[model samples]
Target: MAESEHSSSENASMDSIEEHSKQDSELEFSDDEETLIIRMFNLVGERWSLIAGRIPGRTAEEIEKYWNTRYSTSQ
Candidate 1:
């Protein structure tokens, strides 16, 4: 009886952990994608030249070319 109770508790904990892990993974993925889209928009939207300046080693021209390529392929 004691062993059964312990086993049940362990199972419950494991199930909870698994559920939380799944939720964490989903939230992380969504946040990452949202961040990427926001960055791409901010880079290409108004004040683009300033943002391009903010990121060293990256030029507005190259960024524009990258976006154009992405736009062409995504369609």
Candidate 2:
């Protein structure tokens, strides 16, 4: 019973960490970055790596997720 309780606590801690990371990943982009991302996305299309490279301090995956979540027509 003690071990089970410990395991549950660990799982809860892990879930909180995961939730924080998800929130961090959904970072706010500056106006310039937003404009650049939109323009590059339009010109190059979902080419996230290329777009991320053009923007400082952002990853391809993050940009892709942000665009998909906030701007993608399919969403």
Candidate 3:
């Protein structure tokens, strides 16, 4: 009984981790979202939270990272 309970818990933990990874992967922005982000950046400057608000399911940090990777110049 104890071993079965432990196994169940481990399976649940693995499932939870896999679900989290799936959600993270699903967060990738589409082309329309990227265009919106660019337009929002023009309108709101670096207020990433505001930009994210316009784009559903996106967090400020994610939007900022995308902006930096796609738009910022390397120095």
Candidate 4:
């Protein structure tokens, strides 16, 4: 039905928006940034907002996620 098709289209648009929002929140790290995060993590012990402030251009939530994904287990 046309209504069903319209609803599906709306769902697809919403999905695309969600995906874009997730991508926007993801921050890319340079080698220096990675080193800084590791060092700060050692110094502060998962105090991500402080570490993020030291790194520049990254949110605390993003830094926490990145550290958890990439480095948490190693330390």
Candidate 5:
């Protein structure tokens, strides 16, 4: 019973840490970054790594996700 309680506490702590990391990883692009991403998309077309390289402090995956969320049409 005591071991089970300790395990549950550890699990809760891990859950909190994971949630915090998810929040931290969320994309918060500035106006300039958004404009740059759009212009880069027009120039390069889904070349997320290339676009991300041009934008400071952004990852390819994050930029791709942002593009998809903002631009992709649901079917």
Candidate 6:
């Protein structure tokens, strides 16, 4: 029971996708973003847009729309 409560509290702390991100995670990425981003964007498709700071000048709205459009069509 204690463990379950702890896990729930941990999950609650993740207010947004930002929760999944940490400064350390950024360091894990290679300096060569171009080569890496292409593969990620391909796999994630429109969802890639939701990822902040992935590409300069790409707004959250634009990314959200891209993903929502894809999501609606698939449904």
| Each prediction's whole-model lDDT (CA) | 0.59, 0.89, 0.88, 0.85, 0.91, 0.54
After superposing candidate 6 on the true structure, give the runs of residues whose Cα lies further than 4 Å from its correct spot: 1-50, 73-75
What's each prediction's clash count? 0, 0, 0, 0, 0, 0
Rank by lDDT, highest first.
Answer: 5, 2, 3, 4, 1, 6
Candidate 5, pairs of clashing residues: none
Give me the overall lDDT of model 5: 0.91
Tell me the deviation in Å of residue 22 in model 3: 6.6
RMSD of each: 11.1, 3.0, 3.5, 3.6, 3.0, 11.3
- Model 4, residue 19: distance off in Å is 1.9
**Ranking 1 against 4 by lDDT, winner:** 4
- Residues 18-70, candidate 4, lDDT per residue (tens digit)? 99888755756788988999899889998989998997688899888887777
In model 2, which regions exceed 4 Å deviation?
1-22
User: Which residue pairs in candidate 1 collide?
Assistant: none
Residue 48 displacement in candidate 2 (angstroms): 0.4
Our model 5 lands, by Cα RMSD against the true structure, at: 3.0
The whole-model C-alpha lDDT of candidate 1 against the native structure comes to: 0.59
Task: Name the weakest run of 10 consecutive residues (lDDT summed) in model 1.
Answer: 25-34
What's the lDDT of the predicted structure labeled candidate 4?
A: 0.85
> Which ranges in model 3 have alpha carbons more than 4 Å from their true place?
1-27
What is candidate 1's CA lDDT for residue 5?
100
1-75, model 2: which lDDT tens digit per residue? 999999999999999999998877566788898999999988999899999999878999889888877897873
User: What are the clashing pairs of model 4?
Assistant: none
Residue range 1-75, candidate 6, lDDT tens digits: 999999888778765556556532433434454454545567775555545367665555654554455445565
